[model samples]
Target: MGMKYSDGFSKQLPTLATVGAALVSLYLMSQAMKSIPVGTAYSIWTGIGALGVATLGIFLFGDRASAPRLACIGLIVAGVIGL
Candidate 1:
């Protein structure tokens, strides 16, 4: 959504913020690897990311939240918890 802004500053700010957020997330994930297994940590990280983005898309962009879509999200949550 921020990427769709017409002004240059608005567009660039969101892009920069996204880069900073990603860096922080990666750093935290790397730190978690000290205790958690590599495969499990990676799986949980990706699963949480996917679930967060999907859920936000529904609220922020008015993306569809149909039953099947929700069920898939539930599956991702379950997988993350199982890990």
Candidate 2:
């Protein structure tokens, strides 16, 4: 009777875990913001998120990066570093 609802309820775990991780995320984000302008925070956050997703994709899916991908990753790193 509850088979279909099981998947819906199970999704809460990831959602709650994300909320917890978000707290930790903001800590590093705060560190990233040190001496960085408020506007740059958006850039730094974007770079971090993109880099993490790309890295995870490579690790979990065995995705290969072309030269352009490497360059884009480099750019993201530089953006974070400069922030």
TM-score winner: 1
- Write candidate 1's Cα lDDT for 7-82 as tens digits: 5545677878776777899999999999999999999999998899899889988999999999999999999989
lDDT, candidate 2, residue 82? 81
Instruction: Evaluate model 1: give its TM-score.
Output: 0.87
Q: Which candidate is the best by lDDT?
A: 1
Model 2 segments more than 4 A misplaced: 1-10, 27-35
Give lDDT tens digits, candidate 2, residues 1-83.
12222455476666566667777878877986787776788687878888987877777767897889889989989888986
> Clash number for every model?
0, 0
